[model samples]
Target: MTKTRRAARTAHTSARTHRVLLAAQLGNSVGDGAFYVTSALYFSRVVGLSAAQIGAGLAVAWGIGSIAGVPLGHLADRRGPRRSAVLLALATSVAVASFLLIRSFVPFLLAAAVYATAQSGLAAARQALLAGLVEPGARVGTLARLQATLNAGLAVGAALGGLALSSGTRTAYFAVFALDALGFLVCALLLRGLPALPGTPAVPGEGPRLVVLRDRPYAVLTLLNALLLLRLPLLSLVLPLWIVGRTAAPGWTASALFVLNTGAVMLFQVRAARSVTGLPEATRVVGRSGLLMLASCAVFALTAAGLGPWPTVAFLVLGAVLQVVAEMWHSAGSWQIGLALAPADRIGQYQGFYGTGVPVARTLGPLLVTTLLIGWGVAGWLVLGGIFLAAGLATGPAVRWAERARSRAAAPVAGEPVKAY
Candidate 1:
């Protein structure tokens, strides 16, 4: 084939793969939205679980899942990422279905653990699949597109879940759960349609079994990323509480802020990500995002000045706009830097280990953000701003350190010459 024809064929294939992945992401994200909305209610009202039980059980479940991710991702590396993703997606469907049969706390915990583990593994496997299919230059753009699709899917799913929430009937809750399970089934089928990637083989005496565990530089980056991810719980927990207890804004402003955040992400995330093409740019973007987040927190603090509802609403909206932009920048930068830093053969395990930061932030962020924003109030906001600024500033040094360490690791010992590709 001519070079032009070959390029055209490759572009066509990439587009097809991108479409399949987007469809699968939409399916799974819809299920995630429904579960996020309805799961707590189902546990308390439908399954006879106490609030304390639900909280503790879920924490333990997710903690287990976080630890399980590394090994499960290694399974993807040892087996094939596509096959592992398909299997894990099906397992998630089964675990979601098991929730329908649970009548007590123990069963709920078991089912939740299974679901969390499967979800974690599925994420790793899917990322590995993406890495294998997409070219290095195009991965971040594709990821941004997927992120936008995820936001759109979540909005649709949240709306469907809201209807179930409004009905407040057992059948409605069950329908939501059923829809969630079916969504995973659909995700698995969509993933199965994509081209398969074969397992990567290990070279003899290369390094430790799980190199990511011992990679100190990568660990530092992960920790820093986790700190940035504190924004996740800030949106879900702190902002709502701040609106209700600390600010003069109406309760509905909280919902409006959420819509604004998600909608902006859907519309502009890809554009935000377009400038981040490499590690240096990624670090720069993240650092700037930190400054933005600090400004956003400062804006949020102004709402408590008793400036009346209109001004308070204005401040809240402005804060949310800044916060969402910072979120998009941070997300875009992290995705690029994380993938850029990983070795091709171990992308699955590396991505899996990196992703542990999400659960870590989710677990610890609530306590940290609530303490700073809710308990401490204005001073707390300043402190939180400082924390984001510090983390963002630190990311550049961390990326450089990781790059140096990776280069050292790849360097040959005495008498060993490097081989050209």
Candidate 2:
């Protein structure tokens, strides 16, 4: 193809792909708003669960899907990512719809669990799909746009859902779930346009499920990813508790979170994408992203000292900016690392393996963060941030070691025994 025509095609694909992202993200934003807050609120206010019970339930509910990611990723690898996505999407919609029938706290949390799994499962498939669709050069930008879409869409969703929720959290919860369902449906429908799934080429006799693990560097990256993300669970769960316990926000306004996620994407993610793409390798990119994330955690934790709403909003906005900047670097870098490490034929499985981090963090970090976070307040977030800082700093050296090892392993030694033995 001519360069001009090729460029045109690339632009077209990006645009179409962005539409799919926008639609899916919008659905998630609305649904997430309802799911995280509405469902929990319903559990506490309506279902009569004590705070401890509610926390346990949510932790349990979120963790159910956390451990399931790798297997689901394996399933996505075998079943075809597109098919898995559609199945997950349809199931997600149904799962969300079932929220309408919640009778008690346990049942509601179960529905929440289904909702959580469906969302993450579909997300893993969707991301794997996108990694296949866009060219490597454009992937970071595409990821940024996708993140932006989620931020913007979720902003809208939170607004509408919050308003609807003020009247009754339960009724709005169902509506939010239904909307989330619609996003999954759009995602499922869009998969038809993608002609193939992204993966590493398969080797004979080796199942595709093991594709991501074949490379030691990739495995190390996954471990690093898990360690690096140790703070997200704390940020999501413990931060909220501190905010309410410490601050006197009028309505448990997590608007700061919304600002942190959405607004950050709007401004800095693209700039971050640009910087990451210019980096030498995915590993370096991830490390830098981690450092940026650590900074965000520090900035975010400052809110515990009690900023006026506007000042808090500023910190929140600053935190959001850093978050998406890191997100841009991390998402694109991680995608590239997984793709480079994975066999061309088994991208789905490799991606699934990469995705296993989510549920892992969701499951384990809560107990750790909660135990420590209760006494620390802002200091806890700072400590969490410091942990992220150390992880970030460790990444460059670890990845260098991984690369050097790969090179040495691939090198043929002059005196090494050959098959002649």
Candidate 3:
């Protein structure tokens, strides 16, 4: 074939791969959004579980699931990400489907644990696959596009879930779970068509392991990332309670904030990510994200005074907007840093280690936000803002430290001088 024809073929193939990956993300995200919106209701009404039981079960499940990521990620490295991802997706579907059979606490807990573990494994494998498929320069942009697609899909799924919620029937709940399972199954099928990309082969006499645990810099980075991810529970859990309890804003303000946040992400997430092509830029973005979040917290604190209804609502909305902006930048920065910093051969293991931040935040964020922020009132908001500032500002130096450590680790022990990438 001529050079021009070969180039065209390669471009076409790249586009096709992007499409398939995006489709898989969209399918799973929609399913997740739907399930998340209705899960509490389903467990409470249909499964006859107390609110405390559900919360405790989910917390334990996520904690266990988070721990499972490392080993599962190692498995992806050994067996190949494509196979691991597909199998994990299948397992996730089965676990979700099992929710329908939950008659008591034990069954529910078991099902949740299985589902969380499978979901975490699927995430690590898929991220590893994505790293292999997309060129290094385009990985962040591709991730941004996927994030946008996910937000759009979630918006649609949330609407469907709202319909089921309105119906408030056991059959409706069952149907939602069935639909969620189907979505995962469909995603797995789509993934199956992609070319298989295996993980890095283990080197001879390399001690049979690449110990992520020993990487202090990486561990510190993960901890910082987890702090940033506290935004998740901040939005979903704390903000709602704060709005109703402290702010003079109308109750509808919470829903409006959700809409605003989701809409902003769908519209601008990709744009926000476009500038984050390298480590320096990514670090700057993270730093900026923290400032924005800090400003948002200050704005949120304003609502606690006698601001009246409309004024309080306006401040609330403004805070929400800032939070979303911060979210967009934080996500872009995190994706780029996580992917770029990982060793090529051990992408799955590293990505899994990096991803532990999400579960850590999810498990701890609600408690922290509620007890520290909500319980303390406005002062708590200021303190939380201070935390964001500290974490965000620390991220750049942390990344630099990590890069230096990586260089030292990669250096030859003999007379060869150290070389930096």
TM per model? 0.96, 0.78, 0.96
lDDT score for residue 416 of model 2: 42
lDDT by candidate, in order shown: 0.90, 0.65, 0.89
lDDT for position 177 in model 1? 92
- For candidate 3, lDDT tens digit of each residue in 308-333? 99999999988998999999999999
Q: Which structure is stronger by TM-score: 2 or 3? A: 3
In terms of lDDT, which candidate is strongest?
1
Q: Judging by lDDT, tell me the better candidate of 1 and 3.
A: 1
Put down candidate 2 lDDT per residue, 19-76, tens digits, no spaces.
7666666655665655554655655665667788777766776677755655666666
Give lDDT tens digits, candidate 1, residues 1-421.
Answer: 9999999999999999999999999998897898888889989999999999998998889899888888999889989999999999999999999999999888999999999899889989999999999998889999999999999999999999999999999999999999999999999999999998999766565556577787777888888899888989877788889999987889999899999999999999999999998998999999999999999999999999999999999999999999999999999999988889887877888889889888878877888899888999999999999999999999999999988877766654444432211
Clashes of each: 0, 11, 0
- Cα shift from native, residue 26, model 2 (Å): 3.0
